[model samples]
Target: MDQRTDRPLSPYRHFSRADWARLREDTPMTLTQEEVTRLRSQHDRLDMAEVEDIYLPLSRLLSMYVAATQRLYRAQQKFLGTGDAKMPYIIGVAGSVAVGKSTTARVLQALLARWPNVPRVDLVTTDGFLFPNAVLERENLMERKGFPESYDISALLRFLSDVKAGRRPVTAPIYSHLVYDVMPNHRVEVDRPDILIVEGLNVLQAGRPPRDGSAVPFVSDFFDFSVYIDADEPVLREWYVDRFLRLRGTAFSDPKSYFHRYAKLSDKEAIDTATSIWERINLVNLTDNILPTRQRAGLILKKGANHLVSDVALRRL
Candidate 1:
């Protein structure tokens, strides 16, 4: 009988948080304590130290990558003798629902925008691409809201395609978490930026390709770099539940809030409700879709129970 281990080789060069922090090496910290605090979400545990140790090194590396990519883009344009508009470098941030993907995107956006001579760094979340609540209700897909099929994938792909084709003033639909819907007739504009950060639960997910070998553009196809935020399932559940609980006293309490009904839930009742929703909706989505795409990321931030990044895995080129 063959006794060899079945585990496959990892394509990433993993580093402990301390070692990764050392890689920051001369990368000037541009974000202030106030800025860091402002960028964080209600349940996010990230701080100035986390920014310096985890994000600064990442910011430095991304700066290098963006610069190199732009240089090559210019060279390619020159070779082809095409006078196209400036091309933007796109970055994708993907993870489980409560794993702090927005926090990562905002931190990176702020840091990269502060880079010398890099003018604009815009960030957009995939929530906007989700089908409207009415549409989901009509289609009886409310339970599958975060799944790939629930998204207007064609519109999303077209938006990315236009941006990559050097189209200007591209508009993306806006979403309202407060009302739990894609706000009607609301949109945000994205001009050609030096960098664009696209954050979502499953932006890196590439479903099975067609047997015909026809071109199937994935959201990740336009990404110059991609990041996946990872944590243990129990830790993620805790965070999600905690965030839901916190919302009870805040957003959920507002009369116009979509989750207003949840505000009056007793502590025990709220806990049960949150856990059930998590297990039923978010957890299923994470396991069925998001986690499978982790290996496709260019970098993975592994978080410990306390929500601090315990290690970094940088994919080897």
Candidate 2:
């Protein structure tokens, strides 16, 4: 089926799950079931079928975009007579917390890297750019951890700037989910990869521009393509609570974990605590910051209560 619709003013043309799958059209499957299991998040289930139906089409589309971009870059160099390195093809993946953003990013990375051209792919999360817990506590922003204010946005922007400039060996901070803090002196380096997938809650967010209209670079500025994982607020809350409960038995049980105290909580207490955190922190952040930027993405994956993507929306060019 074609993507054309009668509603000309609508920016997006919607696609049913089955219609989207048809776009895959003879694209070879590169992922094994075991590989998909490794790429999925603990709270997200991604099977081989989902990979074939949703991600293979996406991978095919991205490959075409990347190839076209590369060709344009080569043409530009011939016209300008400059030998500068080609910049990385940046893809931004954004969503509310626990909406399976990580799973989507990881799966895309795996699938894209397996393309026949053997393009190098790297995944970076905005978590590493978040302010340290100590800094958050000192600034009294610990309670608003995922809010836009809690990030060192300047650093994140600078990192994206360097990557787009074809900078060599750019480094970003490393964060420990176990300690709930940025690690001391730990870093992940991005060294001129062919493709870089940036995944985060607020990667697609923008800030107020100056009244004079001077340039202000946002994280999404460098992206060649952007994807937003979407679900209803209630579904997101349920997924978040389920993830919290699962972590309580695993990561939270570690003595060194920042949330170790939560391990011994009774199920009722866990539910109450999880719901409280959701209401205070995640829900507020989602409403105030994340959901507002959903339309900015080139692609949106609308998920069902089952946490699998049920519909896809593409912004018409």
Candidate 3:
């Protein structure tokens, strides 16, 4: 299995599920089955076994990384003669759409908060940073919603900067899936959390250089740690279609849903529409943007067809 295809000579240390599970020895499994069920997304399959085998160990490793980061910050403060103040450990989770990145972020948030040292964990999705429907339509980017160009990159960078600088109560715009737009006047407030998980498709992407030859930091620059969720291309397509079908029967059936038209589609028509959307929009974004950034992640969770993590790759120091 060529897991790390982006890097011919990968710096990551790969581990199978069994081997990764062993590393969690003596680490407390604080989450219950109920909590796992609650954290999982609709139409996604996540069980306690998977949580115990995969996320528990990941949470432990992240906690250690967070602790080490705090120490490093304090040492820097002392060296620079600055006052002591803790910065939130920011984690970026990136992956192809329908590859379970949202569930992964939610699971991590729930598990990490249970740890005594890191009680406050906040999760913010970059969906909120996407251009509004009106703006996208005006720019002729409605069909390219998930693409990097369709986001307000400057706004995202500013939000991340404020969060990294410990600007409390940093507000983020809220995105509405039902409305298929960035909701105006709705915001999610992030009070100084101990750990913040920023989940999105392009969080790991490198920033373009400026014409002035000055430095421009990508959002990944603010990350203390980053995770990339991986899966086969075919598997992602299948999952995307499946999720679309599920949503058609649920959210799309609602009269107010932006995708309500899909609710009236027959099974065959829905399948065709979903497959077309995936091939046209999602696939292009994945190939042109998301997949290229895989090598930039500190950790990779490779999932199998079953939608469960089968292996992990941790970047070596």
Candidate 4:
């Protein structure tokens, strides 16, 4: 078989599920049924079985990468004859909204934690770096919530840069979904982790030169590895609409939610609203910004209409 296309993709293209299974032989699954159930509660469509099948092997592979990074760092230090602190292996996960990137990050964190070699695993979402709702409103960009310009990009880049540079006691702003805004006073600290997963919609975007023609560092530049979750636009549209309808009865019902007003709409009205939002906001952002960066990732997870990852495309090693 042309192993490159025969198996699920990774940074190394020729890996198969069997190959992954072999890599996972000693890797552990730390998540209990109760934990997995609790994790899946937010997205009832995900089950433990899917996690074991899709994520377990991937986490194992990441564990290996994490180990390899540590070894490389130690070797570089020895060659330089100077000691330096170990930095985090930063992983970037990018995808369209409702495309399951959050779930992927959480699952990988849980599974990667099970590897004894990796002591600490931290997951941070770029949502916290999003501009405050008031700022977004003033900029007339509340509708472009997940677009690149909606974020405090320099702040996000600095956080990743610090982490990769072995900086300690780094703190990032926290976001509240209820308020749909960045919480000014609240922050999440990373003293220093063995592995860090940064999940967001546009984390893989390339940097553009400044007006002075000077280079600027982008978030993806700090990534040790990156994954792009992808699917047909029509399929994503349907998924987004379905998730919106589900949230309308739940999170959207809470008065504090920015989308609370949506919960009160009738079924037909809700679907129309969801479709319009997708067409106007999410789809436009995906095409113009998100999808264009897919080739920059180390791996690509391709999903089917059922929302299952049916294909994998790994970049050439």
TM-score, every prediction: 0.95, 0.97, 0.95, 0.91
Which pairs, if any, clash in model 1?
none
Where does model 3 exceed 4 Å of error?
1-8, 213-215
lDDT of 4 by residue, 1-317 (tens): 13544445444463443443444565566788877766653643566666766678688767778788889999999999988888988899999888888878887777777776647999999999999999999999998899988999989878887887778889999999887889889999997998899999999987564677553558888889999988899989998888888888899999889889898899899999999999999999999999999889988887788776666656765
RMSD of candidate 4 to the truth, in angstroms, is: 2.8
For model 2, residues 1-317, the per-residue Cα lDDT tens digits are 54565645668888889999999999999888888889998989788888998999999999999999999999999999999999999999999999999999999999999998899999999999999998999999999987888999989988988899988999999989999999989999999999999999999989875578565558898899999999999999999999999999999999999999999999999999999999999999999999999999999999999977899998888
lDDT of 3 by residue, 173-207 (tens): 99999999999999999988999999999999886
- Alpha carbon lDDT of each predicted model: 0.91, 0.93, 0.91, 0.82
TM-score of candidate 1 to 2 decimals = 0.95
| Comparing 1 and 4 on TM-score, the stronger one | 1
* Residue pairs of candidate 2 with colliding backbone atoms: none
Best by TM-score: 2
Q: Model 4 TM-score?
A: 0.91
In candidate 1, which residue ranges exceed 4 Å CA deviation? 1-8, 210-215
Compared with the true structure, the alpha-carbon lDDT of candidate 4 equals 0.82
Ranking by lDDT: 2, 1, 3, 4
> In terms of TM-score, how similar is model 2 to the real structure?
0.97
In angstroms, give how far residue 220 of model 2 lies from its true place. Answer: 0.7
